[model samples]
Target: MSLLDFLRRRGSAPVARERLQVLLAYERANRGYSDLLAVLREEIVAVIARHITIDRDCVAIKMDRGDTVSTLEIDIEIPHKAGALLVGT
Candidate 1:
């Protein structure tokens, strides 16, 4: 894998020293989010867990800021399961 891509892979625990910027981005965003990331993460897990099984740690939350608006991104890695795919309502 390319060096940059390697650094971008999100894993558990505090990231490596070289990845402090990434860590800080999420940290600052969460702080900017009123330091409620843990609480928000839990609430999100609770709601989604009700519908499907998931590895809670697999959820990666991020916030990217633009001049006018910021975007909140939640990436969840769902494992394959039979008949788990849901179609349009």
Candidate 2:
């Protein structure tokens, strides 16, 4: 089965399980939580930039409390590549 099908079948998995593990690994590597946040933001922007043009100022990332744990939240503002304004007025 495809990855989506696997994920759908594993719908009982707790949210943020993977992200929490990542954050814990970052901490073990002597990286502060804030530092991890910055790295995550940059990586997310880079990944999204590969698919679309994005406004850097409109990019935001943070950790929020999930129903059972903390979850990483990513927000990106992508514009149409063709003649799209770089900034909103």
**How many residue pairs clash in each candidate at the backbone level?**
0, 0
Candidates in order, TM-scores: namely 0.54, 0.48
Global CA lDDT computed for model 2: 0.71
Best by TM-score: 1
lDDT of 2 by residue, 1-89 (tens): 99998988787455568778866775677645557778888888887777667787788887775556878878776666522645433
Please give, for residues 1-89, the per-residue lDDT of candidate 1 as tens digits. Answer: 98877777755245666478765775676665675657778889888888888899988888776646778888887766712574322
List the candidate 1 regions with Cα displacement exceeding 4 Å: 1-33, 87-89
lDDT (0-100) at residue 56 of candidate 1? 95
Q: Residue 85: error of model 1 in Å?
A: 3.4
C-alpha root-mean-square deviation, candidate 1: 11.4
